[model samples]
Target chain A: MSETDARPGYFGRFGGQFVPEALSGAITQLEEAWRDAEADPTFGLELDRLRSQYGGRPTPLYLAERLSEEAGLEVHLKREDLAHTGSHKLNNVVGQALLTTRMGKPRVIAETGAGQHGVATATAAALFGLECVVYMGAEDCRRQRLNVVRMQLLGAEVVPVESGTRTLKDAINEAMRDWVTNVDSTHYLIGSAMGPHPFPLIVRELQKVISVESKAQFAAQAGGLPDAVIACVGGGSNAIGSFAEFIDEPDVQLVGVEAAGEGIGTGRTAATITEGREAVLHGARSIALVDEDGQVKHAHSISAGLDYPGVGPEHAMLADSGRGRYVAATDREAIQGFRRLSELEGIIPALEPSHAIGWLLAHGRDELDAGATVILTVSGRGDKDVDEVVKVMTELGIAGDLGNEVVDADPREDPESDA
Target chain B: MSAVTDAFTRARDEGRAALVIYLPAGFPDMETSRACLEAAADSGADVLEVGFPFSDPMMDGPIIQAASQQALDHGYGVADDLDMCRSLTGEVDVPALVMTYVTIPDTRGFARFADEAAGAGLAGAILPDLPAGESDPWVREARRTGLDTVFLASSVSTDDRIDRIAEVSTGFVYAVGLMGVTGVKDVASDDSRTLVERIRSRTSTPVAVGLGVKTRQQAAEVASFADGVIVGSAVVQAASDGEPAGAAHRVADLVRELRAGVGSR
Candidate 1:
């Protein structure tokens, strides 16, 4: 991040403070506290200690030899699924929880989609002894019942929001309202790198540890950098984290796989970068699915986590600058990815990152050079998604390949301009 | 400009705070909403806040959010609501400001939105989502067309932040009375008093306190220390709950009481 990006908060016209008036002071204070923490070495040392002791740092970078041999390429997986919360969401929440304590706020509020971030936040608040409240869509609560139970076990109050589309977007709106009302005693632990100023930066910095660790691990194992790094982009937290360290490496291709619920350009997708326009959603100016009159539309995806209508502003900047390439994977394709990883590699991948795996399987072998090395960040484990995935598979009647075209072979090439 | 600035001046001269009332556009129907705005003005509301209903009102409390949802369900589009604004501002004598989210103006180009607002005879706008830092584009366009761009001062704002808001805010500095959304409260907090005082010390702009100012007592309490007392959710509740014939009248009655509350102070 540049100095200008750190202070005034603009990622090439994508990031800004577009929240309600009541949140401005809290955001400013958070930015200052975050900056101070960044400057303090003690903060980093303590966070590292917690990361290692409590949250389990330095997850493995395993070479998928069988899968690579099948694809005729070198393939590696960053096992974020092995994180404490069974997802990579633990990275940002732990950082924010520490910041909440530093700010002297006793309560933390967050919004969740698939309940992975909610579970991570609840676990952090339990560890920190901070009062935790999570807002989740009522529909999501029904979909991810086990994770809901996990959150309650962590001693966090889960609020099922019934307003709007009864989904992640509504949960986020409800959480913001809670923050505006109780900002004096509470800190909003935003689950993604999508919201207003300081948040996109704060989350990126905290989650950047993923890319930092993976870079070192890959270098140690492969003796060189991978030609491509890919991850699924919901609000683009894990994708940004995976791409952050290798962003400036021009030779390294950064691919972000979005959820095309039905199909791209079908008006039934969460592929914001691929089929959306520039508009303000939540607290940042980013590409969002909006109607002609500027009202935001509800996003659809088989995976609750990727059912968000918008992407992080930095991802917008990356796509705009041609530093990152974004693609979409349909629900069938993601399921195929999930089955492939579980069957071939004995890893039940989360539905969210299955989009990435889907993209790689459908295109990686043909697109990448013969000797090219590829790294895919497995953002979460699939335990939370088992029932939902099974239900989807059963409904679609997919005991085997249904002759679905997972890849079009014709790449969007430029997501920024296409939208 | 005359309606808003003159209302403040008149209120100051009369030894009371101005009573600002909020009602969403096209709640139930366009005609009823227009009649409600006119009735509010006739019942002694010093200024009127015309809410352009949005699909997601993230900053609003349940009451206001419900009202907005009802209005949106009534099929109130952005441009059509502005037409309502034009009709009400043209008919009513008091200044009417549009209170909405940022996505409204952002959907229509800022300059075009400003021009249409000015053409509609609106006094100004208050976008709760468009804070001071990121408001340059909208503010510049609004100012270009001589529209008062009101900015809000939260209860948690620093003195420097209050000063910054007071300096840029035109029609009035909207000082949030509490740390909550637009809703009803039986009592007023001391934080609003402190915020208004801080704002008063920094700039000459009129300061209006909103957020949770519901009842007559609460209105009077805020009016004792502030230049304007804004009532939103209560008025919206009146429109939402009352019968068709009594809805506008109910809003007018509450505005009258709030007006009396300001006058009593």
Candidate 2:
């Protein structure tokens, strides 16, 4: 990335801080602190120590032979699912939690959808002994009860946001309100590589460790760099992290798979980069699913993590510059990938990254050469999604049939409501 | 002077703080929202802020959020907001401005939005989320269209930041009464008084305090130290309180009470 893109948080006309003045002081303070931390060697040392000692970093880059054969290419998995709190989300929270301490802020507030970020933030807060409060959509709390309980058990207060769509966007709105109110004493540890200037920059820097390690690991294990890097893009944290170190490498195609809920044509999807227009949402100019009049629309996905209206602004920049290629996978396809990874690789991948696997299974051969190697980041483990997946599978009448054809079920429709 | 600045000057000349009432256009529905704006204008409101409801209003409290949602649910759009501004400006003597998030105008193309708004008789616009640092393009567009740009300054704004905001703001500088979203607070913040003083020390632009003034007493308290007192959520609450039949009257009554309070200073 260019220095101009990083400073003042503009990525080729995509990212800028468009927040209320009430939070400008806090944002400025955060930017300054982040700059200072970036320059300090001790900050890097501490973050490294925390990553390896606590977050279980250097997560293995394993060659998934069975999945490779299925995709008709050599497929490798970046095992972020093996990280603490069961997702790559831990990578960001730990860094922000440390920054919160460094800035002398005693409280941290966050927004969560699938609750992975909340769970991760709560875990980090517990480790750091800082007070934590997480805002989640009321609907999401019902959908992701296990993660809600995990956050509560980790000593973070989970506030169920009841406004707007009662989803991730609403959760972000509520979190921002809290941050604006308590900015003097609290730090808003934004979960993704989205939001305003410093947040995308900060989260990317912290989560970039994924590719920083994966690149070297891939070189050592495979004797060369992979032809492509793939990860699911939900607010684009893990995808950005998986692609960051390789962004400068012209040969490695960076692929971002977005959740296409039922399908993009159905007006029920979270495929922001694929189907959205350029608009500002939740503090940054990014690709957002909005109506013709520019009002942000509700985004849908079986995976709560991927159900957001907007993608990271840098992703918009990357897509604009043709440095990144974004694709979409529907709910049925994601479920298939979810089951496929479980059976083939003995890993239950999170639904967020399952989109990447699904896209690869459906379109890998078309995008890659016959024997080309591809590294895909398994952003999280899917123990949190087992119940939801089972219910969805049963509802689709494909519970026991792994070889069943793709069903045309709209997962967002409530059959019971119709009844 | 711009109509918004003229409104502030007229209020200053009358020896009282300006009463700026904010009502979301197309709230509940378009007709009732227009009625409420008319009522506010008829009831001694010096300036009218017609809010364009956005899907996500992060800086707003529950009352405004609900109102905005209702407006959006009614299929209200930027064009509707501009029409409301035109009608209100024509129907009443009070200067009317459009208040909304930046994305609404940014999505419509800033220059195009500015031209349409100015053509529709809007005196200016207040985008709470568009700070001075990232406002050059918008300021340029508004300047070209002859529309005043109102930028917000909070209690936490440093002197340097306040200076920049004042420099760019053609309309009165909006001093957020507290470090919170737009809602009613039981107690008026003393921080607003200090913030206004700091702003006054830096620039001669009129300062309006908003974000928490709900009642007459709070309005009076704010008016005692500020050039303008803005009431948004309370006015919205009044319009949403009982029956739709009496919403306009209720809005007028609340605006009259706040106007009286502002004039008491």
Scored against the true structure, residue A51 in model 1 reaches a CA lDDT of: 82
TM-score of chain A of 2: 0.94
- Going through the candidates in order, their DockQ values are 0.74, 0.79
Q: Is the docking of candidate 1 incorrect, acceptable, medium or high quality?
A: medium
The residue ranges of model 1 lying beyond 4 angstroms of the native Cα positions read A2-7, A365-367, A399-419, B184-187
TM-score of candidate 2 relative to the true fold: 0.96
lDDT of 1 by residue, A1-419 (tens): 63144337888878888887778779988999999999999899988998888878888999999878766778899999998999999999999999999999999999999999999999999999999999999999999999999999999999999998899999999999899888889999999999998899999999999999999999999988899998999999999999999998888999999999988877889999998888888999888887755777889999999999989999988887788999899998899899899989999999999998887788777777885798999999999888888778878887444333454645576677676
Worst 10 residues of 1 chain B by lDDT: B180-189
Candidate 2 wrong stretches, greater than 4 Å: A3-7, A401-419, B184-188
* TM-score of every prediction relative to native: 0.94, 0.96
| Number of the top DockQ candidate | 2
